[model samples]
Target: MTTTRHPDARPSVSDPTGPPGAGRRVVAELLDLALLALPLTVGALLVDTLADADGGGQTDRVVFGGTAVLIALGILVWNRGHREGHTGASLGKHWTGLITRDRDTGHPVGTRRALLRRGTDVVTTRTAAHDHFTPLPPDTGVAALRRRRLLGLAALTVLLMLVLLASVAVGARPMSFAEVYHALIVNDGAETDIIVHSLRIPRTLLALLVGIALGVAGALIQGHTRNPLADAGLLGINAGAAFLVVLSIYLFGLSTPAQYLWFAFAGALTASVVVFGFASIGGGKSNPLSLALAGAAVAFFLQAMTQTIVLLDQTSLDGYRFWVVGSVAGRGMEVLWQVLPFLLAGTVVALASTPALNVLSLGEDVARSLGTNIVATRVVGIAALTVLTGAATAACGPIAFVGLIVPHIARAVTGPDYRWLVPYAGLLGGVLLVLADVVGRIVVRPGELQVGIVLALIGAPFFIALVRRRKLVSL
Candidate 1:
């Protein structure tokens, strides 16, 4: 008989012909579980402390405890899928020098298979541990990916310019291309010039700014957490802004967009800080699982409070409804001016962090080995996300799905590189929002739908298609 040794083989006395024994697997899992639990424990303590400081009763403590537990479970779920899916190695497995591979092909498994394996292990606890797998094709080279990204950016830029023109041209009042050009260039004193300068131009600019901010924010949130489903709306940012806008209307009778803009911005910033703080309890670094769970918990809590207040007062609801629906209309250059600095700063931060994000995506161990400062990267990323999301929400009343959908579309075109993804996402986001605004204007004629409503209509179907196709987790 002849024996062959693989290049990466490690000898095991107990399992001479196979993988690691069940005992080793269990021990590795226990270690990983302990590591995962550390942050949850810290989060629980912090939540308890905050509750006590706020003079919260037993009920509040219980609520916080329950939320902490839910977050822990969410973290477990996220970790199981993410750690095993991407590298075929959980933190414990990696530490134990045990790597999972396809049983049939003896190759690394993709994210879907890893998730399935974890799911099966949960459901059929006593079943024989076996897996069947197929090998993945070779990866595309970096140069090829870059070329594709460049092409995508070029295409998206063209689309965005067309949409910007359309946004300026098609509105409650229509104007010809010639009139639009003349108004923009010649500064003619015609009715076209008044509409273009006074109404369409400002709103269009606002749309572009809001779109860029939301898109980049969404990308940052998703990349930082390594969660494909992450979005500003899902993370309580939009709900937070909505809650404050509602509060301002009910308490202070703030009617104009300008009056509630600062309130909305403050609310957004607060929500982000709370979410980050909760996620960073023990580790000081934001884990993907913690971020998602914290965001969800905050979002649900704020949304409930907002709904309760709106239901209690009809006048507040009437005012809140408009803001909650999220439109770029009725905004002028002043609104743009107010948010431009924050948005610009956020955008610059996002672009600057792309390289760090790229490194961070390669798992913490790899990132650390490559000399990446994981904590600093996460802090910068979160700051960018907060500023961008807050500015956009303040300006546009929390437009949905621009952040969620645009990045996915950009990713499909640009692959997983953040350098290309950020710019592409920003451009695509502007295009999508402006296009949605134009469609909303046209579909209802003089009675236009808000951009948020239009996006929900468009984004829902696209999201459904993405899930059905199982492409949502491509990142």
Candidate 2:
């Protein structure tokens, strides 16, 4: 007897070709488990160190440990959702050449269905066969996705502008929106005008510039390295700058940001080159794992050196501590002026490198086949990354996670295209930093939380949520 089949029907599960075997999958899961535990481990270590130094009571330890545990649980759940939900691949999966896709359509299972699939998989874990497929809806086509992205971006843009305006209006000395507008336009001999011109406007502009720089730099770094966790700080840029800034203070008594700007820039560039050089040493071409490991090693070394220098000199430590925590406050037009040209140059380079990045995303062989100059493209990207991250770190003392978190947010809205990703990242980053700065001011009352501290507080949960909500392993 002959079997009949419909032309449109496809198998619910394909022949497991290229699917990671159980052992490989287990290894990948272990790797992901390690990554998930990393933050909690670091937090615990930090708490222990601080407690030991301060001779803290058990109450302090208990509170800190409890908080850390809650945060860790949230992160774990969110990451699990993201890995199993969106792309059906976690960090380990990406490294191991595993993918979760609809067996029939061969498309990603997507976030919602993926969550359902995960739930079912957890329940049926005792069974022999753990293989499962979540069907995807019919393709909506590229144009539809683009349209949705555009709409989302436009909304975010509007929201960002509102946040900017609010940043301009709210501070230690609050002003009405009308007052802010009046001060900007009129500039009479009023106190508000002085505050607006001399303090608020410059700070807000600096925030915008720094945000754009870090955001673009992050997108470039992630694209070039193909690592979701890659950031300027991770590459030792921040540690390098901080070390040089401390050295300048220790040696030459350079106190102001403007005085140490060049030192920071030079250090950042030098560190980036060293990291890349080390990563490239054994390579046919430096893969993401090599780059990430090299960066981590360099960052740790530089940070250790900086700590030693600071510990040896009390005066230098006092001066360096503030900058290390990262803030845009107290920065004037001079520091902004110093970093502006470099930031502009980096932005231009980043934008121009977008096409190359898009091609490179398709894998090196494919990019070369399509006539891409892979070497030149990487060089340009690294140059841009150095300049952008270096300038931003120089200006703002290494504000954490703007580079790491903003790009992921932008990517969610804009999809994988670098052209849209770059701009969206820039705009959203500006919003995030400015908003964070504003929150920092308000949260601690008359005294302010440093923007960096506030960002870490906010970004940690968001990062966990993002990991839970999206599939981060794909190109």
Candidate 3:
């Protein structure tokens, strides 16, 4: 028997065996990486420009440039709407030529169709999700799936965009719509640039990256575990990373944020393994609910231990508070680089599992008959999840809803196909966090809400709704 796959440049629904082409995926990723890296690179260049400069000039320049990029991203996102959602996106979609089109007529696409397409995509993706990792209601109606997906997408876009725009406007030196517009486009060295760079841009970008990582990681983990509730932080990776910092402070007396890296990485990896083992322990297959429970258990256990540690040592407590609460503030390029390798590697592995996840969705007997390597698939998925969650928690100190909420958002747009779901989730995730973080910056006038806090405040209701869901679906 010969194995076949989709061409990486363009994914064909008909072809399921080929690796996704690099060009489409890579270009978009590179663009995002550049966004993350550019701020610091520019800041460094500015510092170099004025070696004899005091902190004030360097600060102003760094802040200004960073803010410009943030505004660009926000405006870019706003303009990215094809009625809604990304089209010809990722590096590969450009090369392989992927475009969102009218589902039925299959024409060049208009805003209404794009919106409808997004609506369907989310339904298909989420409904399929119901069947794959966790079971939806017995004989869950197609119509229900469609509605959920549409509602999810609508909720996300409305919330994310409003928050982002408001955040941009809300700042220490508040600017009217005109000034903000001038800073974003004209870019004549003014206080407007400072507003754009220092607060709005960098924070938004950081939130974007963090959200993307978390959203993709959530999809991977959820798809892998088959548990709708499974989140990157829920799996104990967040606590592990935080605990590592706690350990470092308690033992080594480490102080700088830079010093938190190794410990965070170590913590993330360790937690993943422990959680995996817990999920897989029973003789039966590791269901999504079991995995989620395992993760929740581990997370609570670690958090309790951490709180105890904090209660004992104020120094450790001081270090842990900001990180545990989850914020995108004060995160510079250094933090981005330090955790980037893990995020990239993890995302690759997760993306790699989409085919297997698709097969798994067909159920165990079918998967085995088709030679899907269920055990191996599980291993790869778990590993991918570990790497992704580890890196994300390490980077952003356990930002939550991006992972939990973004997949649902992606599903609303792309449907339940893991193939499209994974990538779109990443984009939607980026958009979500950027909006959230941006809002955090502006909501309370300069003091900032902190991305984590904002998400929790928002995510709390969603999470509660999920928990309150009366119908428990079993596959």
Best-performing candidate as measured by lDDT: 1
Ordering by lDDT: 1, 2, 3
Clashes of 2: 2
How high is the lDDT of residue 334 in model 3? 72
Tens digits of per-residue lDDT for model 1, 140-171? 88877777777777867766776777677666
Q: In candidate 2, which residue pairs clash? A: 78-468, 82-468
- Stronger candidate by lDDT (2 vs 3): 2
- lDDT string, candidate 3, 1-475, tens digits: 9976545555456533233345644564465455456555664564454332322233333344455566555534433333224332322233333333334432334344443445322212222223332211222477766565566557556656655555565455546567777777887879887767665666565666667778888888777666676678667888888888898887887776668867887998998788778887976566666667888898898888888888999899888876777777777667777777777887888888898898887788899999898878888887887787777677778787778877776765656678868877876877767766655654454366877889888898988887788963221
lDDT of 1: 0.78
TM-score of 2: 0.70
Best of the two (1, 3) by TM-score: 1
Model 2: runs farther than 4 Å from truth?
1-139, 466-471
User: Residue 53, candidate 1: how far off, in angstroms?
Assistant: 66
List candidate 3 segments past 4 Å from native: 1-170, 175-200, 280-290, 470-475
